[model samples]
Target: MNAKTTKTAENVTRCLKCRRVLRNASPDGYGPKCRKKVRAAARAEVVAQYKPHQVAKAQELLEQGGLIPLRANRVFLAVSSDGSATYKTHRAACTCPAGIKGLHPCKHRIAAHILLAA
Candidate 1:
């Protein structure tokens, strides 16, 4: 019932899930495959926490150029199709209704992520 251990100059660790010796010192002691599974689980957890409409709205915003960055990435303004400004942000959401309401990531966040990726 005891996990295997590996010793190196840096540290000694064992895989918490599989009880295998870990070559590197991961906080969770997960091997490569287990780390992938952990990441996937975390992603799934985040996806499950969002409402369906939020995801759809983010996708629509990305596709329709609804997000406009003003002043050299210092701020973003997200305009809806109806021509109403729904969100604004510099480093974080400033005046988004969804953000204000504490809902999941609004379109502004998604747009900012896309812009940063570019």
Candidate 2:
């Protein structure tokens, strides 16, 4: 027979709005529903902080990766199957058809930008 370690229900989990319990919690000890809301809020905060700077830096270095600039501020890099292009301030779009369909910039762009930043 296994002996129960003697722990109260409050020590493990807390009641959620819909009665579904959560196994994890916020660092300060939030109940399941509250923990979920807190996690979402934290993720949003992180995205807001890093997205803009990351896009701008990536755009500025597009040329170093053998890309051609389509505009004053845009840069394009070629891939084996397609091409990639981005703007100095926004990397969300590129000239490659794959870009039109929504794909990530490639290693060359990344390396060029990294060198430029250095």
Candidate 3:
């Protein structure tokens, strides 16, 4: 019974994703390698869901430092295409005209999503 209790405690210290033993368990339960893989998968999924042009735009925005995260990374301030304005951007919504018109997943939102995936 004592040995079984020790085994159970050992299992509790293993990673949720890979079952690898960790010296310190993370709050999300994934080990470092698994967390990285998960993030990469999320990024790939977001890229696949968007059009090539939209993904390109989002990448360009990131390269040009056009998106600024806010509210503990929950929101973003994205630069306008005209370079004269900024919009409040979220993963599901954006304050840009295209987003307001119900063009879901606008460039700003895509950029924000990419940031989150990263």
* CA lDDT scores, all candidates in order: 0.56, 0.38, 0.73
lDDT (tens digit, per residue) of candidate 2 on 1-118 = 3358765557554322222455764333345454355345334433343345554543333322333323432343344323343333224444444444555553334422332222
* Clashing pairs for predicted structure model 2, backbone only: 67-76, 67-77, 68-76
- Candidate 3 per-residue lDDT over residues 17-118, each given as its tens digit: 445788786665556876676457446976898888888878677656577656776788889987999999998999899999975678888877876765
Candidate 2 structure, TM-score to reference:
0.24
Q: Return the TM-score for each candidate structure.
A: 0.46, 0.24, 0.63
**Candidate 1 local lDDT, 1-118, one digit each (tens):** 3345754475567653344678776643456765565345434534355566755665466445565556665576777657755567543564777667755666666545544433
Best by TM-score: 3
Query: How should the candidates be ordered by lDDT, best one leading?
Result: 3, 1, 2
Off by over 4 Å in 2: 1-65, 77-90, 103-118
- Where does candidate 1 have its weakest 10-residue lDDT segment? 38-47
- Top lDDT model: 3
The candidate, 1 or 2, that scores higher on TM-score is: 1
lDDT of 1 at 111: 47
TM-score for candidate 3, please give it.
0.63
